[model samples]
Target: MRQQIDGAVVLTAADEDVMEYLPNRGVFMAQLLGRDRGNAFGFYRGTMGPGCEISRELHTETTETIYILAGQALGIVGDREVPLGPGQMMHVETNVHHGLRNTGAGPLEFLVIGHPDF
Candidate 1:
């Protein structure tokens, strides 16, 4: 069943479900909002342990934007590698292969928003 937000919905961390995207890598994600919730886009929060990296991948029809919330990471967009930290943001265009790697000593947390419900 799709969840419908009648008005303003406040999602607390304690109410969210955390999933492991990669086993034994300390990579976890929590889906905060999505089309199933009546949103036109998808919103997620991800955390990566030090030295962990997301395998390179791309969205064929959706564009993704990520905002670093804590710690540091290296964002690989196409052929460039950009260092990002808290308060920094990165955009990955549709069909562009991209990935992120935690480069800090601590956990790397970030918010991911994708258009068209990725």
Candidate 2:
């Protein structure tokens, strides 16, 4: 699963890819790029059902950049809560506690990019 065109790699919805869904977590994620592509950073597309949440946690070695694609989100960084929506983005530094909750009525879709291939 990868596509190479003119020395560039491209992965689209049309590509047959594997997506991981955790019912208990109410999350579905697709790794678009990472070790499988020999990339140093990881790129993923994730979705969470309404009312679902990812508990606060810290990544000691990985920095994460999240970009919302659709729906709304309530992002918790450290002790602060920030509201997010489509086209908005959030950056979480390494070792910082952060989490996200789907605050919209529908599914929350977003992109997550992490360094060091996490």
Off by over 4 Å in 1: 1-5
* lDDT (Cα, tens digit) per residue for candidate 2, span 1-118: 4678876886684354646554337877878778767467888888888998878878998999999999999999999999999999999999999998999999999998989777
lDDT of each: 0.87, 0.85
Q: Which residue pairs collide, candidate 2?
A: none
Estimate the Cα RMSD of every predicted model relative to the unseen true structure: 2.9, 2.2
**Could you tally the backbone clashes for each prediction?**
0, 0
Candidate 1 per-residue lDDT over residues 62-82, each given as its tens digit: 999989999999999999899
lDDT of 2: 0.85
Q: Please give the lDDT score at residue 113 for candidate 2.
A: 91
* Candidate 2 lDDT score at position 107: 98
